[model samples]
Target: MSRSTSHSFSRSRLAALAVACAAVSGTLATLPAHPAAAADVAIHDIQGATRISPLTGQQVTGVTGVVTGVRTYGSSRGFWFQDTRPDADPATSEGVFVFTSSTPTVKAGDAVTVSATVSEYVPGGASSGNQSLTELTKPTVTVNSSGNPVPVTTVSAASVPSAYAPQGDPAANGSVNKLPLRPRAYALDYYESLEGQNVRVGSSRVVTASDAYGELWVTVKPHENRTKRGGTRYASYEDQNGGRLQIQSLGALDDFPAADVGDVLTGATEGPLDFNQYGGYTLVARELGDLRQSGVERETTRAQKSGELAVATYNVENLDPSDATFDAHAAAIVDHLRSPDIVSLEEIQDNNGAKNDGTVAADATMRKLIDAIVAAGGPRYDWRSIDPENNKDGGEPGGNIRQVFLFNPDRVSFTDRPGGDATTPVGVTSAHGKAALTASPGRVAPGDAAWANSRKPLAGEFTFRGKSVFVIANHFASKGGDQGLTSQYQPPARSSETQRHAQATVVNAFAKDVLKAQPDADVITLGDINDFEFSGTTQRLEAGGGLWSAIKSLPKHERYTYDYQGNSQVLDQILISPSVRAKKAFAYDSVHINSEFHDQISDHDPQVLRFRP
Candidate 1:
């Protein structure tokens, strides 16, 4: 979630506009005088057929409309007006944003006419390739009357485009961000055409739960590929699912409805189309529809069957002793995820936890977590890990987050060996007709450039039911610099995946070496891979069929372990080797204790897999 740091409109003009446009009664009094040569201009004519305003850089006179909404605060000090009379073409919207640079004097239901210069304002300046918003700047307002009904246009399911964006210039390899608008065909184009228009979205389903910022994302098309939880899935690259729209209530924050994923919005929600930095095109709702809960609840704890070795992976989101969320996290692991025999824990911060004074030991942090788990009715689990060099790992500065292992002593035992450290690489060796690690809990290819400034994979040797199994815990590079879905560049750039791909290559190679040494080696590579199951990083890891994602055993909609913008995407995965995949006794479940709820202990949900070795 992002906050608006800068004003959407000019701040300099705000004070003057506020003083000139004081609150007035319903009666039309002290109307501003108009010029003798004022020519009537329709809102649609000014909007034009394309995204760029046709009458830009020119002064237009005698623009008339009924005020549909008013924004009194923020940099976008303006009132939205819709034309009482609309155009025949559905592509052109009959509304416009009049920038007053201060508190809007006009109120909803007021009939008004204005003479102003048509200007196109590009947020973040000209260097930003973002779409420009059309506005009437430096305006003189005249109140014709009050209590006039505002015109509203309904956006039906058929109006929503199926395609997300237009095919940019092929010569530029889609790098050319700007392209001509196709309002009829593309989703972005269709929304841009209705920018600043008073529109109604009817009977929409909530795809994203409301965030801390009081924002919700909904889909108007009910026929889209939807999850059982009521969220529309990003099923394929071809289906963009243009029905999605962001809902923003700029009114009193308390008035904004609290909604969750799978909720339904009944009746029509009336709002003016707004384009901003956080989300491309949002509906600034003046009247919200009724919210209906769809009875979606968090999943229960997974069951572990007899003669099965249960393993799980969870990203604890920088857990530390100082953080107050440890107890809840422990309860989630014990009560909700069913306490797997061996669990890969990621983002375990240093002992001090965010105190930048160069403390790297996490014994205190780990002990506190283990104690809490025991108090929560879980087994006494022993742990193994190697501390990273001070501040070398990339994460919250001073946090020094790394991966650690927790194994139930009653069910499993660590096969401890020598020569494991932060910089040394772990290798595979044949022992007793089985594949084993040189060091029981050793780092994998730590000196490789691919592991620089990132958490190194921790490989551990464990024995369960007289059988040896190896588990590699990894925390890959985060998606920090990836372009947002609403980015000006079509098919937004995923630059962060480059490092993750390199990391995946090294891990995959290590897994293959173990398989080569012992054909039936039970190697389980699991942790917060920080990429989607269908992503290129996952494909690279499973390229040679060395590892198989256990999450694939479930249905497509049930594969998510993280939620972003209301889309449940996979970030944490438990991938098993062919020896585990070939067996038909494997069972996998994504225990959903956190991601969907508001008071989440971590951003990611835990994944548990049970298999017989």
Candidate 2:
């Protein structure tokens, strides 16, 4: 049968057609039909048929399917569901959804009929130019489940699947493999500990979720099918398996009490939360304590003058194309980057060794910054990054945009020597959206010909005050806009949410491996995470993994390192162990703009931290 007809097949039933139709079929053809032309509808007349376009904002009704999901609005409700027509494509047709004052009885898997008003989606649509949905509605449904209707809590840590098995022996397989770029050892260990534990979590932010390995995080959430496969069975079967969250846990949201989405939280009494390039919001556990009526306990503040250990991050405002003024820019950049023992730099250019100047360029801007660092004075700085030369891109090609760290060699030393292979660096996508490598400068990975052309992340181990600190530098895909998704009928362009999570997962894997090598290892992850503390990326990276955000331990003034178009956020950050933060091991800030006279050399300001170790 043609692929279009194959939509009826379930996951287990598609084994034969999977290989036969691989080359014949493109995307399946069961997408939603053009919306209905009318503005209003009679609720009694459309009980069994699929509901398309309705009067733009008029109340309409139909008994189609159960309210499989209900998104509550303080007083009203919203959700989607399957149509009652057996021959109709429930996967493609607008399932029943509702926006009303009543909190309808709906969970992810349970299905019944819903009575909702018909309406067209709101304004913005399309990704990479493909048609997208803004809004759809269903009225209500009859609850068939036992007792009272059990609400499907937005998949959180508190819910555990029945088949869950604790991940023992770090080598054991997890729900998914995280990307192998800069690994997050502590984060991975903590996630492994909760392999089978039941926990409560929230849909903190909408982001691409990935597994422990550097791959996509796939799980089933009722009617929602994330695997991109056709038919509802896949989601139905996997829903039994449960949805997957990242290894990094950013603590509970109750700690910060962010009233709305996209809020940046800092210094909750609960300790630290992890942030990432993907999305998700998070706060520390200590902060959660403060939310209680009893108030926070054991709170302490330190003097800033006592030689604090520092770390900072910045988005170098298109820090590419090496020009003479670039050095002045680099110095100015560093001046703003300031005194953290480590600094994360984003948007650094990469050359695939095929340069017009007859030089094998890594990221020219990164190279120039390192040269400037040496010129300013050596030994105060030393850096390690990954630059694999991809032979596919011509020899005179350019490298990718990437994230790198500039560490004080006098304070930190390398631990993992680059093993001749392409070490999974930190990034998941290049500045322009290519899956390439972007390293600062240092030893090249063995057999990594593509590193020269890509903007992937580069990672390494270091020592400070005789203590080990593993630094994982990353720059996630940007969500600047959806212009990249402007296509007529093409599959949707990769969402920044998903790609960023992929990169975050890659770092999570690196962390897990590190802990496997050293169970009691002391690690610190600091960089330009490209996300806010309360976002999904941060939550998964912190809650799933064990990485901690230093912002939770610091005062608010130092919470954010970059301000764009009035959006003050903590994109650059430093996440350390609870033990380290307790000892006051570091301090950081959104420097340069805050402390210097520089006219914002880059989009991100510098940060500083000081510590004995």
Candidate 3:
């Protein structure tokens, strides 16, 4: 799946409140400053030693701190203030956000007293599994003084813990919300302990590009899981790449720099550390660093040799005939990917593209791309795909996004067996010890519940270098319902994996069927898997030793096709059977192009695998 938008707390809080419902709204209501609301404890005491605040749901009075930052716009506007005098406990945060539900009059450096209800505001929602943000909501704030200097905390490699998260409590059913904050050991604990505080970071490398919402990602621990191209590699779930932090500006979007991966943010960037729905811990910058272009160029994979059959996977990010990026996408395929002999395309939409008028044919979409490819100096390509039943395939509604195969006729041939349709199930068969598909361009287990409302695996038989190669193109179920990495659950719930694991088993069974039919069958499966190589999904795909994720063949640092939230992780991959994997000379490349740049036509870096079957 692709990612998104503005890191605004107000909008996020609005959604969070709506999701948490009116009961939470009532609990965190504002009241006039009175003796009843006068607990008057230090900010750190309220922040407590755990992910959840100790003073949640309590009315507190005379809470004093210096305003470090203020959000005066949007429905959930508030000001972040830090206590002037701090206790010596590292487990408690000295700063806190005061939610007013409207514009705040206080400015940075103003000393203020707040009488409000302390709350553990969960971003997204309580069910979203995200860590709760400790906040003083619906406050009656009184400006006590002006021009007080806001204390700034510097964050660097040495300041952040190498460990990412703490173990969840078994009593709480894997919830870490009540666990004591291990600020010195866990990165999440460290960030949580400093939430709402004024923080500063020096010049740093931009890992994820500035998205459409004028936000980017930076890392303080530069060397943690460092990729060769200046990014972090999220190799596994256990190693969450703790140093990565999202960057957002409190100022106007027009002033925010458009930065790409490998760019450097020169000088100092300072802001109040806050938690939002889109990304967990973020620095909403009052002062932004200057963006310095690092001259990072799109990488080109070496052309496939005459003996090698080059197969690739590229997710065009919901491409339709009307899409404007056709030319740019064509150029990437020709110039950057060296025009792989066979490319598996994901998220190819219908002609009308989200019109939702029951249209399902995608001939126009494929034709536009093929024509653009030819114009970009690539060979004329032939594509095969099955149009899904309207609204059945999950994606942009009415777009009817489906997996497609594009093969170069000059270099390879597509086997077009008859009778393959939207609902037809593909079966593996053997003809004279050669593996073949019952319906060449057919759906794999189309009726299976595992593929409900998702793109069914598109199976096709092909001939390359006079050798039969069976390829199963898949755009598996996305990570739509999964909990975020910064969830309250210590090992945050990957709820989406259940469906993917089932999908993998379906694909795995199909591959095993073909292997059983033809023992020496050369089978390859590749597409936007929407999961990591190390996940249960991949494990299911590789279950019976029938298929192996070819991306794993590369060095650990170089095995990613997408850069998400500053972690270079694998979402797209190519898997091959023992017939292909046994030939260890096969080369694989996660061609660096779209995902690293803001000028991307697709959010995925295409994966290319070259092997002599």
Candidate 4:
């Protein structure tokens, strides 16, 4: 028998029995004799072990016991072991296993013989605080009167968790006949009212579109005419009145190539009642009911012309810099982000530099940012970024900081802008020099850095609500406690203000030029401009450029986005042109999502405005 706290077998037979005993015990041990003898032991009776441990360098043996429970931990790649053997007391059988490999094959309730050398834990000698089992050998074992291994079967549809089952797959979608019907079971309020019900819903009508990860997305309008099936409410997409159904796919517009605006699809309806991932934004699709194609509605420009739009901007402070930062929290980083329909982020480090340990290059930074966004919430955002300035100096490790834009492809279609050798001139000369600015069909470049270091403007045009909207997302110079002649702080040459003011001038000039190009254009300029509403920099845009400030109209208590020294200031803003704001139906609201330090998730808060023009 394997060496144990107690005894049962002799030395000669002990070697062979040692394997069985070792396998039975959940631990390992080493013998005081030859190493070859220890290696030769083959376990026979696998499941009935009382104790198991591993051996040391010396000739030793281990203890083994039947496993009671197994649980997954950490990254879902490992497991822990609990004991439940005949001779083993249930009280001390709470065994914690240290798998031989990072990923183990064994699972709970398996009967096996483990050969190991066991010893008491050596405090902090690297292997956590558990006894050391250097080698875990699986020997021949018997379970439930069977000599061969027990067959492990994958859980079938009947055994699958209710959360992921029938009617969930793409073809069936989230249809009701696929879910277990029970009245008010598990807090399924909407579906509970129709427990044990069967209903027929008309084909769903396509509504607004969304695109994420370069994939196309379409929202379906639920059918409104109601019929009762087993007491459950059933309707078709055409009947939804104004409500919509959202669906996302990983292919481009040409993939399915079947769906079009006003297309009618018929399918069963079910409950995704708890779906609220997008919060206020319609980016996330909650399953209204299963939508199967019944027939097609007449094809028309189903794109409704609503003069209302809600635009939100935020500065996701220095998103990811070096590889070290990216690797450390890649999963957590992806989990917390909320993808707005349109997000204007600032301070996204582009090139690695001395400060960032220079790991993610510009191209790499862009790739990582894209991956991060998708991992957070997939099939929602289709990326359209301005190409980085290849000629600019590469900072720290990642590269230079380059501002970028990630748009929901389904809703907005884009037109790239022009590019040129335009550079943000350095020092005093930059303020006076003719700032090079260009507009192309679908491109932005390194030369754009003249606006902000690692933070430049990303301008693009996309169609929304049957109208083209121009978006200029930028990060401006920071407010570093310096006092300039003007409250907006435009310092003279050689001062920090020199670079700051030059950057602001570049952004302002671009805004003016773009507006002049489309006299009646719907223009939205948003980002961390770093200038308060009361500041002259913004005032100049309001007075001279005729831009409408979104924050100025909000109540004083809700105007601020960030607070410093107990005083709140609206440093970030959204400025719309008079033509867009003048749409009477375009009543706007500015919300301070991060107005309070306690309520803030990041250092900077996100500002949102809803206006239809």
Candidate 5:
């Protein structure tokens, strides 16, 4: 995150934000004594039955409601108030957020008449593709009375629609912003209808663990695409978990209990429905339910048999020699992952990680990890990799993070050919119907623009039990600039994928070249692909039957190595050539040691595959 992170917004929207900022610059002020009369409307009618408000950008004078919730904390200080009398239509929400942008004089249960301008304030800005939040901005309030009864709508499992989102109007360019709310049909529309309303959810299962930001995710549909590890698996774009809801407290997070996945929040969890950028719609709870521990535990994969060759991929999250997680990572590799014959470690930083000094060597880092693995009762692993140019790879500055191969010398012998360097391109050479690497432990197309500012794939050749095997470890471009799933742009655009697709194309071409050299070539390409197996990147890599992601072999519910915002999905993968997949004896397991746990050594769970070569 750069300090100068900026977004380009339309002049009109920029002016609106400027006016909003100026409205509540210092303190709260009451309504004007003499004001021009304007058309009065109910809160639901103001909210309308569409994604966008019907009275957007209009000045409304008379609005009466009871303050259901007040948020005096944070920069966006305001209160949620609801009309005591709701309209007959269930599609329109009865509540709205008063964007004071500062501390308010009113409290919950205070009945008041508000004169304010209706504004559609997009949470993360319109350019972020987030849906606009209907708010009463630059308001003038006159208190009528106190201790008024506020309505609390109970939202049970039956209330949430089975459908996730609406099919956007094709004319509107697949944006549901202009679509009418279908409260009984679509979940997004249903939540949009209840935006800012006081609601309560019955006992729910915690899907995402509590984070440092004092937030947790719970699902009303507890059994929806659930994983054995007690998480909701995000299978595909069309099959997303609809019941997932983010939960936050109005009060201090210190009072909120820490919880893991599968933990239960017993009883009713009441809050005001609000839409934000972090995770789309959220429940800002005023009273939190008591947490019931679920007793979740880490998982270990079965060790490889004597005749089998085990290969694993793990993203250590920028590990260096001095990090405290070395012991834990070593143990995870040795005990949980069961000490595979070869491990592809991503994000292995240079010695003295992130230091600006021109020290690009990572021998110290590798030695430290190897020593820890040995201490943890694992093999003395020999390693091979190319040190990336300083800051050339897209990782922490000066860290020079790159993919590395840690192989047990006792189990496998590296086919070390000459002339392998950081800037050299590794190629395939065919002789006597056998395929061999031009350079051992070499980079694939180091000078190609596809790998610009990204980790280049490291290709290594080894002989396992007199059978030659080629492995290409890749850590492709990340998904930083892509639009999120809840974006106003339906089926949000993945802008960062252009580079990943190019990278995948390059690696796939290289693998195809090897397969062309020998049709039965045993080639394995694996690492942090940074995209799902169902995505175009994966398809590009699996093009022409060059390689197949072994993760697909597992059951749909068990096909996740990373969890992002409670969606158990895949990022790391181990792909095998058709020759290896053709073998009858092949097993894959994603060791669940990290992602699900709050205290994680790495954000990714290590995946291992064993096969007779």
Candidate 6:
């Protein structure tokens, strides 16, 4: 006999007496009713036509499924269950989350019947514009059997759509939120249809390396706008790669393996579909896949040719004397980047290195790095910089980071002139038919509002091969207060871009002043602009046809100096005046090292530009 909490059935067959009793009525009735009448409800029935549950606020009974996954510790204490027999409709998912608010009593692979009240839970509460999750709250589980087989659904190229998102509704503030669900026509719809389902992925390439948050982004199709390093190239706002997906491990942090770009995730990985704040739709995997290294190594640029001057830009990421990354950073400049003739360094801290005892001199800090470079078999390079007023520069608290210039005295000579300080603004002038700085190694427009609380531009004059080449180093305003793509705002606002635009205008005007002074002057303006090549900030810097970004000289896929969220984008740039731009004998390379690797000394990869003046 089989019995439920509300009903019971007989095991023995009925005798002829029961049959004879119904014979007079011309109908033969069995001892018990049909088994389906007691268990007609399915998981898909509760998860109805829309994102919200159709039977919400109504208590349902006899929902039967096999438990597929269980979360024991987190606040979202729940177990995922899928119906033994799925529906034919591809739009409706057969799996649903059963929230118990406590440890689940039944383990995975157990066939259990549940009775619960359906509810929709939003992750960020009511005000957040995030999608709602359908769940069964206040659930009571009755284990029917054990060791049941759990079904795994394979997600492949054909399963997802080629489009990233559906066309937004013009009436709904340009949001795709109201678009009808076409599961096979868009990536967002495809993920939404499988919400809370158990899925498996086959061999895939790692797009983004494993981050500190224990997440890895991968792409099933490796040939779609892929970079040489295995990362998907985000061509523009319109070409978002739909094959990208994130793999989040639900196991121990230490058990999660470290991976780099171009690595492959082999074997089968099964997990439950979860939508969270970090990435749109993530697969929280209980079993992680194996990582296979692609034998991809960091690149070393060719050494400078005879009579060619090599200039580089590096953002050391708040290099302070107290930090121990100096030696590794120097080796990158010496061995990997080939020790350029002149390098512009940003984020150099004060002598005391964040001690903040009113100390503004960075002589000791500069000497330490210069010594480390020589010890690493690099050239004996001389440096010039002006210390900022105490705590005026914005960076790590008390760090007072600023830009500095490093040059090989044997290859180039710095033109020394008087009257340069931390507060004075420098102007461009014509001297001996070339562009000259009013104060050599001086700050440009220090009093301008665009430079307030920011690292001011440093201009220096140097002579290479009997020709004067002017270089301007800059560290602009950061990209802060920018909303993420998954935020409530449809096309999230880039709030930091306004200040960066103003900062670019200032730099552009200064470049124009230099170009106006000498039309054929060899001027290179380069540093960590903290913006992308295609961004408006770069366009503004290149406006008036005065300066051009050297990063544009390389192919679009090879222009990135930084990686974020699996997308390799450009942040560091080298812009040159028209004189240098008009020349045919110029080359640039964005050295690949720090950004794609886990063991990085800095967060940015340095860019090297070789040219003859």
Off by over 4 Å in 3: 2-39
Evaluate residue 181 in candidate 2 and report its C-alpha lDDT on the 0 to 100 scale. Answer: 12
Model 6 CA deviation exceeding 4 Å by range: 1-64, 72-77, 84-89, 96-106, 112-144, 167-172, 351-361, 389-392, 486-489
Point out the worst 10-residue segment of candidate 2 by lDDT.
1-10
Better of 3 and 5 by lDDT: 3
Q: Model 4, poorest ten-residue lDDT window?
A: 1-10
The 10 consecutive residues of candidate 6 with the worst lDDT sum are 1-10
Tens-place lDDT per residue, model 2, 70-166, is 3333222334443333333211222322444344445544444333444432112312232112123433344433232222222233333333222
* Prediction 4 TM-score vs. true: 0.40
Candidate 3, 1-613: lDDT as tens digits: 6441100112343342222111233212333433323337979988888878777889888888889988765555778899978899998889988776556777899877778788877777777888888888767777767898989999999989988998899999899889888888999999988988899999989999886666899999888888888888997888999989999878777898888888989999998898877778989899999999989899999999999999999988889877899999999999999999999998899989989899999999999999999999999999999999999988888989999999999999998999899998999878788778999999999999999988899999999878899999998887776777888888888777798899999999999999999988999999988889998999999997999998887888788788888888889889999999889789999998977787777788899999998
Question: How do the candidates rank by lDDT, highest first?
Answer: 3, 5, 1, 6, 4, 2
> Which of the two, 1 or 2, has more TM-score?
1
lDDT of 5 at 488: 72
Cα displacement (Å) at residue 532, model 3: 1.3
User: TM-scores across all candidates?
Assistant: 0.88, 0.42, 0.94, 0.40, 0.92, 0.84
Note the Cα lDDT for every prediction shown.
Answer: 0.78, 0.37, 0.85, 0.37, 0.83, 0.76
Top model number, TM-score = 3
RMSD of each: 5.4, 18.7, 3.5, 21.7, 4.5, 13.0
lDDT of 4 by residue, 84-104 (tens): 322222112123333232234
Q: At residue 143, what lDDT does model 3 achieve? A: 72
Q: Give the poorly placed runs of model 5, Cα more than 4 Å off.
A: 1-27, 30-39
Instruction: Return the lDDT, model 1, position 357.
Output: 89
Candidate no. 3 TM-score = 0.94
Candidate 3 overall lDDT versus native: 0.85
For residues 339-452, could you state the per-residue lDDT of candidate 5 as single tens digits?
999999988999999896877889999999999999999999999998888888877788888889999999998988987888999999999999989999999999999999
Q: After superposition, how far is residue 491 of candidate 2 from its true place, in Å?
A: 22
- Model 1 TM-score on a 0 to 1 scale: 0.88
Worst 10-residue lDDT window for candidate 5 reads 1-10
